[model samples]
Target: MKSLLKALKRCAVAGAAALAVVSLQPVSSAQAAPAPVVGGTRAAQGEFPFMVRLSMGCGGALYTQQIVLTAAHCVGRTGANTSITATAGVVDLQSSSRIQVRSTYVYRAPGYNGDGKDWALIKLAQPINLPTLKIATTTQYNTGTFTVAGWGAASEGGSQQRYLLKATVPFVSDATCRSYSGYGGLIANEEICAGYTAGGVDTCQGDSGGPMFRRDSANQWIQVGIVSWGIGCARPNAPGVYTEVSTFASAIASAAAGL
Candidate 1:
C-alpha cells in the first residue's frame, strides 16, 4: 500500500484538473488503531474541541449523537471484529471525557485505490450530548476564507499539539491544487482544498479525519469537508485536501439515519 501522502501526490499529478473524480485506497485496518490524544486550548468561536479530538486518532468526525464521519482509508482495512473508540468533550487528553464505539460503517467506493475516494462512517456506543455540527450540501465554499481545526502536528516535522489547534486559511481553486504533481489528481469532486501558499497554518500528521468547516449563507456553521492529506503541514501551494462533506450529503444522511 502506498503512503497516504504519496497516494495524494500521485493523484495530483495524474489528474490535476479532475482530481475530484479520482478514487483512493481504503485505510488499512492495522493502521486504524486509536492513537494518543493531544491536549490544547478550546477554540474561541465557531470552534468545537470535541469535533477535533474525537477523531484525530481514528480520523473521524462526530456527525450525530451516535455517528462519526471518517476516512474509508482509516477503517475499511480493519477486520470485522475491529473496535474503534471516540473521545468527546475533551480539552485535555489525559483526563477528558470519552465514548467507546459500539459499531462502525465503512463506505468503500467501488474500485478503491490508495489514492481515490477514501471515506467512511463510525457509529458510537451511545449518543453524545454535545452539540452536533450542521451538514452543508450547497456549494457555499469557494476561493478564500475558511478554517481547519484538528489535533495534528502544528508544523511539518514538528511535534503534535497537546490540544486542538484551529488555523485560518483560504480555499484554493482546483486548478491551483492540481498543479502539484504528487497528488495525482486524486482530489475528487467531493473534495476541497484549504491552506497557505507558504508552509504555515495547515494540518499535519495526526490531523486526518478532522473537520474542515465553512459558514453558509445563513451564517450558520456547516461541515464542508473532512481532513484528508497534504504534501506537508501548511506547505506553500500544497494546501490540505478534505473529503467534501457537501458532496456526500446523501451518503452522510443515509449512514446516520437522516441525522
Candidate 2:
C-alpha cells in the first residue's frame, strides 16, 4: 500500500502500476507511505506539546521527558544516532520558538519486520519540559473517535504540510477493516484501524509514528495507536492502520525504563 510515511519525505513519482503493487506492501522504511491528513484543520500553537517531528520526515510522541515513542519503520536499527533530531513545542515547522532535541540513541522494535510490531523509542540527549502523552494499557480507549495530527501530506500524492494538521476519525472494527478489498489479510489483531468508509480523513505519510489518541474520562489525552500504514491517503474502503499501543504497553514501559 502507499505508505502514510511517504507523506513525510518527498519521493520520485512512481508509475501507476508500481503504485498498485505497493498497495499491498507494509511500511518497511520511512520513505514510503501515503499523503498527509486530508480534510484536516490547522492546529493552534501549544496545542500538542508532546507531538514531535522527526528529521527523517516522521512524527512521534513524548513518552517521557527524555524518550519518544514512534513507529519502528521510521527509524533504523537500535543504536546511537546524533543525527536524528526531534522538533517539538510548536504547531508550525518554521516557528522560532520550537524546541529541537538530538537523539542520543534509538531502539527499534525487537522483531519489527513490517507485519505488525511497528513501535520504537528514541532517547533524547536531554529532557524537555513538555507534558508526555499517556499510553493506553487496555483496549478501553481503542474504540470511538480518535484525533490524529501530523505534518504529512494534505492529500493523496501531495506535498507535506508546514503547519501541524489534525482531524478526527471514527474507529473501524478489525472485521470491517479486513472486509475491505486489498486489506483482508493485512490487518493484524495487534493493529487498530480508523477512518471513514467513504475516505477523506486519515493519518498519512509523514504521520508515521505519530499518536492516534482520544480523551479519557479525565478529559486528558491518551494514545491508543501509532500511525503505521495504509493503501493510500484517506482512500475509500481503506482505513489508516496503526500499531495497537495497548498490545505493547508493558514492553514499551520496559524499553523506556532502560532508556
Candidate 3:
C-alpha cells in the first residue's frame, strides 16, 4: 500500500503518484507494535477519555456526548451504511472497560477540497458521558506546548502501538515551517506546523484524524489542529502538519450543534 502521508509529500513535488488520501492499515498482532507518538511516553489510563480508536484503523476525539470529531479522510461518506465503530473511555485498545459506539451520523466538512480543512464529525448511536475537547475559536496557539495522542506507529514504517501514547510538540511558525525545502508554498493557512526542525517527535500512520491540542487558561484542553498529513514520520525539515482547528470552528459548530 502506498503511504497515505505521501499525499502532501509527493503532491508538492513534480511527477509523483498523486494520491490525496490517507488510509490506515489494520494493525496485526504478528507485526511488532512500536509505540504511539514518536519520542513520547505512554498515557496513564483515563487521562484522555475523549481519545478513541476507530475500528476502521484510526484515532478520533469525542467532541460531544455523541459526536466524534476526526479527519474527513478517515472514514467513508456519512450514511446508514457507515459501519465505523468507535472504542472510547479507555487508554488501551485492549482495555475491558472500553465503550463501543456505532456511527449513525457522519458529516465531512463541505469545504474539504483536500488541499487542507480535513475534518469530519461522526455521531454515535448513543451518547456516552466522557470528557470532551472543545474546538478553539481563538488562535492563541501561536506558539506553545501542544500535545498529540494516538495509537499510531512510533516511527515511520514502524508497527502500530497497542496502547495510547502522548507527546509534547512545540508550535513552529508558518514562516519558519515554510523555510524548509520542498515545503515552501505547500503550507496552507488552513494548516499549522508543529515539531522540531531537527526531527524527533511526530504522529505517524494510523494517527491520522487525531487531535493536536493544548491547555487553555481555564485549565481545559482545547483542540487546535487535526493530524492531517506529513511528508514522513518525524523527519528533519518535515514537521507534523495539521488542519487548523480555529479555521473550522464555525464549520464544526454548524454541523454538530443541531444534532
Tens-digit lDDT track for model 1 on 206-239? 6666666766678766677766666755445566
In terms of lDDT, the poorest run of 10 residues in model 3 is 14-23
Superposed by TM-score, candidate 1 places the C-alpha of residue 119 at a distance from the truth, in angstroms, of 1.8
After superposition of all CA atoms, the RMSD between model 2 and the true structure is: 7.6
Residue range 1-259, candidate 2, lDDT tens digits: 4343333322212100001101112222232223323737787788878998888878889999899999988888999888889989988888899899999999998988766788999999999899999999998887866888888777766666788887877677777778877666554658887776666666665777888888887999999988877777777777787889999999999999987
Question: Which 10 residues in a row give candidate 2 its minimum summed lDDT?
Answer: 14-23
Question: Which pairs of residues have clashing backbones in candidate 3?
Answer: none
Q: Rate the local accuracy (lDDT) of all candidates.
A: 0.53, 0.75, 0.69
> What TM-score quantifies how close candidate 1 is to the native fold?
0.75
Which residue runs does candidate 3 get wrong by more than 4 Å? Answer: 1-39
Weakest lDDT window of 10 consecutive positions for candidate 1: 14-23
Error of 1 at 249 (Å): 1.1
